[model samples]
Target: MTRTAILVGITMNQVNFDYSMEELANLAEANLIEPVGVITQKIDRTNKATYVGKGKVDEIKGLADYEDVDLVIFNDELSPSQIRNLEELLEIEVMDRTRLILDIFADRAKTREAQLQVQVARLKYELPRVVGQGEGMDQQSGKGGLKNRGAGETKLEMDRRRIKQQISQLNKELDSLVAERQVQRRNVRKMKSQLCPLLAIPMLESLRL
Candidate 1:
């Protein structure tokens, strides 16, 4: 099923705001999220807690309810506190541009190596966000149908040390895959080198004939 979302952006008098928001919508579409509404704020700075002004947050909440959106996508990378605060205020799932991009890569990743790398990147991103929000994380993480949006509640249950251990393990597996591929490539090159001489003899015989 296609998940619907509300796109939120802030323009600090930047010229590329429109382009950035449009790209965010495309990214959302790539992840099978239909953008039902857009809310923009032109602020000198973002609210420290919610990333948007208080009034804008309320507006987003109203729009989210009206559109029945499953999530809200922010144009910029939000701090962990900002994410938590916005979700609490809006009573909906909240995600940032960084999270959207990560999810896209995770879903499209085909090979084991690529999958491992994406997982590692995701864990690193989730680490700080999950620090003091363990209880909340359990309630929200991986609660939806969006694939690869969160690291799953089980991982969120893990302490920082455990998450780091997982990241280390994933890196090791990636390294092993790289080494295995290197060996296979070397063997292929060696076999090709040996076969070239025999191939040259056949060509020489044909030339003589």
Candidate 2:
């Protein structure tokens, strides 16, 4: 299925801004996303809270609403807070380049090793973002303050623990794969060593003249 997306980029003295945005479009295409439009901001630096200027964000939000894009993709990596902020303002799905590339890698990963690696990378990327899951919900639960806080904390802790466990497990599996490959390489070297004498016999016979 093809999802429509809008590309957003901030040009802060970057000579290759155009190239990077083009690559971002290509990446979106690779992920089965159709880039319907591009929005760029020429700023001295990116806004910490929203990634782009407030005015630009408003324009982007209007453009996204007008175009009816499924999501908006940023050319640069965004902090968890930044993503949340943008999604709140835009009222649409928001993604950054790192997540976008990871998605592509995950989709194209066919082998077990490749899949495990991708999973590990994704877990690492998501670990920090899990800590603030219920910020809004906590604020909204004015009456059941203590209960809501406790539940949110417990859930957040559980998520962190789960992601950590998965990352550890994936690392162990990868280590085992590495060890197996090393053993196979050693066995091949041993076989080559054993065959060296036979190979020399042929050379010796050829030099009999």
Per-model C-alpha lDDT, please? 0.90, 0.89
Which residue pairs come into collision in candidate 1?
A: none
The local distance difference test score of model 1 is 0.90
The regions of model 2 sitting more than 4 angstroms off are 131-153, 199-209
Model 2 scores a C-alpha lDDT of: 0.89
Off by over 4 Å in 1: 132-158
TM-scores of all predicted structures: 0.86, 0.85
Q: Identify the candidate with maximal TM-score.
A: 1
Pairs that clash in candidate 2: none
Residues 8-93 of candidate 1: C-alpha lDDT, one tens digit per residue = 99999998999999999999999999999999988998789998888888899999999999999999999999999988999999
